[model samples]
Target: MTQVTIYTQNNCPPCTFVKNYLTAHHIAFEERNIANPTYRNEMIAHDAFATPFILLNDEPMYQVDMDKLNQTLGL
Candidate 1:
């Protein structure tokens, strides 16, 4: 099973988009809000300084690259 993790920040439209996309597709994802220091640190650890940082099976996807996301998920 692929483990999906999404790093997001508050007041981010892209973050909402990603989350909605995943939900609409029935894909299970763990959302890590960057508002939390621990999650922010985790995002920084992945070298991502923006919202909608997605990790699919531990692979990182920065920003809202739907093409890359679809390809990765075999959609």
Candidate 2:
């Protein structure tokens, strides 16, 4: 199984969109709220400057490029 992690915050439409897209595609993912103190250092360590930052197998993916993402997942 592919491991996916998404860094997001509340009230972010793009974040929600990405989550929904993943769900619709039956992709399993873990969501981390960037606003949470527990994930703050992790986010910083990953150098995620934007909301909705995604990680695939511990590799930082900074944007929601659906085409590339789908291709990466072999979807």
Candidate 3:
């Protein structure tokens, strides 16, 4: 199974959208909210300075990147 991790923040619409999209597709994922210092630092280390940073098997996406998301998840 593919491993998906999402770095998100509180009260972010795009973050919610991405989470919902993944859920709707039944794509299991690990959500790391940036509210925690560790997760925030991790996101920055990965060069993701925004909310809804997604990682699929360690590959990073800074935004929704619908094409890449669909292709990666085989949706």
Candidate 4:
């Protein structure tokens, strides 16, 4: 199965929006709080400088472009 991971921070509207959107679409994803120290290295290693950084099948997606996401998911 393909894995999706979202790197996000607390109180970020876009992050919440994306999470809700994914859930509404019945897509399962792993949520990582960038505020957490445990994920700091992972975030840096992936070069994610912003919140709501999404990874689809291990590929980095810096911005949440809905159209692109839909196309990727064949939705």
Candidate 5:
């Protein structure tokens, strides 16, 4: 099984969009909220400077390129 993780900040519309898209597709993902200090540090450790930083199978994806994401997931 491929592990998917998304690092997000609070009240972010794009973050909500991504989560909704994933949920709608029945794609499971682990979300790290950057609003929390611990998760923020975690995101920073990954050198992520933006909200909704997605990790697909441990590979970092910094933007909401849905087509690429879909291809990566083989959807």
Candidate 6:
């Protein structure tokens, strides 16, 4: 089950890092790209205005923040 959501945009290195980190850890996640107008608003609504904004169990954060995210996900 996916407990992670990452909001990203094209050519953002941090976004790629977040995705690659998740993949490396075998963590499942839903990707929401801000390139989509709808998703841009969603990310802002969640108080994440940057690429690689991450949500773990509905808690908002930016970038990987593995320790915090893993804590939330009970990883």
User: How much does each candidate deviate from the true structure in C-alpha RMSD?
Assistant: 1.0, 0.9, 0.7, 1.2, 1.0, 1.8
Question: Which candidate has the highest lDDT of all?
Answer: 3
lDDT of each: 0.88, 0.88, 0.93, 0.86, 0.89, 0.82
Instruction: Show where candidate 1 strays beyond 4 Å.
Output: none
lDDT by residue (tens digit), candidate 2, 1-75: 779999999999999999998999999999999789878678888877788889888878888888878988889
* Deviation (Å) of 63 in candidate 2: 1.3
Score candidate 3 by TM-score against the native.
0.96
The numbered model that scores best in TM-score is 3
Q: How does residue 61 of candidate 2 score in lDDT?
A: 88
Q: For each candidate, what TM-score against the reference?
A: 0.91, 0.92, 0.96, 0.90, 0.91, 0.84
Clash count list over all predictions: 0, 0, 0, 0, 0, 0
Candidate 1: C-alpha lDDT: 0.88
Off by over 4 Å in 4: none
List of clashing residue pairs for candidate 4: none
- Candidate 4 lDDT, tens digit per residue, 28-70? 8899998888775687788888988888888889888889788
Evaluate model 2: give its lDDT. 0.88
Alpha-carbon shift of residue 72 in model 4 (angstroms): 1.6
lDDT of 1 by residue, 1-68 (tens): 67899998889999899889889988889999988999999999999998889898988888678888
Per-residue accuracy of model 5 over 1-75 as CA lDDT, tens digit each: 668999998899999999999999899999999878998888888888998999899988878898989998878
lDDT of 4 at 7: 91
